[model samples]
Target: MSSVWHARCAGLMITSLALFAGTAWSATISHAAAPAAAHSAPAAAAAQPAAPTYQHTASYQAAEAKYNQIRALQVQAFDASECIRKKDCPSDESDMLRPLEQALVLKRALETAASAGDRDAAYFRAKVAAEESARFNEEADIYTGFQDPAYKRSAGLAYERAVRERDFAKNMLVAGAIDLHPWSCMLYADLNMAAQPGVNNRDAAFNAYYCAASGFADRGLKDLALKAYAGMLKTGHPQHPYVLDMHSRLLNVRPDNPWRKIEPSGLVRQPATTSKTSHH
Candidate 1:
């Protein structure tokens, strides 16, 4: 009986070993498939990138920016050529305006593009050219007419008026050249100079005021000049040498202050044959 029991126990142990071997074989097959599946995707990806190349949005903007800058410069050159042909700067020996002159050039380029049926291109060109041109224009306008008495006189007054107004005071001089191109710079200058110290700045202020008031008048800035003149008087620049006799003329012609015969009269009210001021 004991020997029979031992043989039965040995048979049970063999059956358990076979079951464990089958499970181990199955686990090995399953793990091998997982690695193949994971590796296949990477291998395919490494073989080649997707069909369409990738580009970030920054690349697009960068390309556009470069094109606009280069094309705008080209168009600007073309416009300047046209301005040369038109003799817009009549004083120059060449048929062209100053090389730095830009506004007219930009407009000319736009017209050329429009004539060629490239209205969209013309529009974009004008927009870009204007930004570049404005910088030059602002610079020229500021320095352009400084030598002219009208502009200088206006600046003188605007600086003084700005003292009290601090903000609105400059309007006194700018009022004279509302329609002028170069006039705008002096107006801005007048506005800015008002904030400067009055000690060393007084002479300049007086000069600008007189010029703005009188210059605009001569330049046909009639209304603008009148306001500039009035503001100068109110701001205490009326006694400035350039303004003294002129201011007196304006007062004498006034209808409200009892003087009727003098204000509108020219500073030199004598016959046109009066002795001329020295030509410095």
Candidate 2:
């Protein structure tokens, strides 16, 4: 499909996902670690040549197709979210329903590709898992984790999925973060803040956000730096004593920043209003 189609699809996906507030999707990546060496490494190395790169495999092609689809779905989802923000969304339920249904189809395709050991598919799966993990965590908060049995069970499932997916997605993100990849740093921050079991580390979250913000600033991407700062604040880590010092640097960042002019409608919290009554 063309780039325009991809964008439209992504917008649709974003719109559908946004229906579940506090679960917005974001871009992310991961890096896998090197396997340990075998005992007879020298002999094995002499007997075998390196394997071919993925570009030469059919799995690569399949992954590329799924990747494009995922990107398109993400774009469409975002666009749908934008429509809702502008209050221009279609009132008809199907307008929203169809794209969501399409997302399921794409997800199945992604799974198929991943089962084939496609790298891109694995990455996409991890991204999807990360989003789900964050969503479940937010939902889990309402029931306070161990409070309600039914809610706990449901949330537990989500938590499990998120953890598995994050693990699947971590390698790439770690690699990218190390290289100071802005998106990677920000994504790593997001994954950390999901508050999933064994994944909740305020210090690490603080560092990832700080890395992203400082890196952006160094590259003169003031707008991105501001966004990163906002992420840091939103991640519930603002009170971390170690991160306290950076607050001053980003104190000026506001919910109305121009960098996110196209942000989703609910991205910023609106102030409460009071109704006044008059008696004659």
Candidate 3:
């Protein structure tokens, strides 16, 4: 579809995903050690001959038609989400469901009506994944390899594209008035599936702990936030800045903090509530 559609769809996608509160979608691409010998296959292929690039201009009309429909659905989904956010009650008539639920259900219908399993149908999903990945430096290089710096760059680009695409699709679904509540969950599902299983579980666990702490802090759920910080300390992350920053947020009111109660059990007591954290 048009650029306007692309932008609108993307806006909706981001709105839907952000609903998950403190949750995010992420993608990663890794560069591995190269083989001792250079990759000869690509070199040989390059030397053998050159092939013409297919523009697919001949298929533009069909692509545009599909793009336009997806675009419209995205708009619909966005509107539905607004209703859900404002606490409009669902009356249970055909017209009243959370936008997230509607978004997913609607998208499924679109997917069915369109060419089944068509690569085009996934265009927006791919874009969202790509964007989210780029934020953390992962990109996709579909035709490239981990061996080339260009491959890494391409991979990052692809991931960024995927993130953007996914966001847009979900947003569109939400706007269209589908089960909007689950849109974030759905986006997360896509994101987690695309994430690296993680070579560093220790880091991941601590990171999650701190992340939860941050959310609780924002929501004034200080007790829960402190407990989260304590949970991370239990994991013994060596108090890196990432970990310490989280603790610092608790120093004030810490004695009053729930975690400090464990001091009798030998947990390091957090300082008094009147105290403040300093960089020193």
Candidate 4:
């Protein structure tokens, strides 16, 4: 399939997942309707606390605006690349490189701000690096079919930097009493997975899967978490002891039947748990 098609499919899948999440959330609210109705109006309002809001600093707002502009250029670059692939539009590969260079410039500026303790800049910088890394990988796939080691190495380094910046941002935000949303946690897991790949990075892969599973569970997506755990066990990529430890932890915290017991080899004894969750 063309890269454009893949991008379209991914967008569609994301939309579907959003719908699914909304449906699941509605179901959860419905299940609590009876108990919620038992309380008086004021008591019910108190029980269901309002969502907290944060005020962004002026510096953060300025940085965010620049980030948005950079992202728009990045999307144009992607479209240009796709046009080249189709051979249906007058496009130069240089069209793609120009925006990437701009992104790098912005990334450097953000780095400076991040060093001065700007958490929002740090987050935007991580996002730019991650997207740049993904674009590098996509270029290699579309043009060289993974035959270029330089692209792979560059992608890996960019992803690694993204993870570092994102971690720093998270720490800074937490210290400032800012709570991270579930999507932020999921993005961290994605960065980890992108940074570490295949058998050579088993420990890193384990960390990625562990992060993903735990984040999903904490977000009330236990079924998705179980699927992540199942992928870990089926691959047998992680250390046996670590797998066993994770199994035990899941059983204690989530308490699902599939994680009820573990085998000597650290594999779940029960049948594989399935999730209805869809992904791009």
Highest-scoring model, lDDT: 2
Candidate 3: segments with Cα more than 4 A from true spot: 1-199, 234-238, 251-280
**Model 4: per-residue Cα lDDT over 1-280, one tens digit each:** 6999999999999999999999999999987996677656658658896655444569779778878978887788888888888856777889988988887788678778877867667666666656655655554445444557876776566555545554554443332222333233334445555553452544544554565566555655667677667756754555676467667766656444543675456754667888798788
RMSD of each: 32.0, 33.5, 35.9, 26.7
Off by over 4 Å in 1: 1-12, 28-120, 144-280
lDDT of each model, Cα atoms only?
0.51, 0.65, 0.50, 0.63
Query: Which pairs clash in model 4?
Result: none
Q: After aligning candidate 3 to the native by TM-score, how far in Å is the CA of 128 from where it should be? A: 18
Count clashing pairs, candidate 4.
0
**Deviating ranges (above 4 Å) for candidate 4:** 1-63, 76-104, 145-188, 195-199, 205-280
lDDT (Cα, 0-100) at 198 in candidate 3: 53
| Residues 77-179 of candidate 2: C-alpha lDDT, one tens digit per residue | 6567667666566744455556767777877787666555454555455566576566655665655556768877876676666567676566546755776
> By descending lDDT, how would the candidates be arranged?
2, 4, 1, 3
Writing each residue's lDDT as its tens digit, candidate 3 over 196-237 gives: 545334444455555556655665667867776776675546
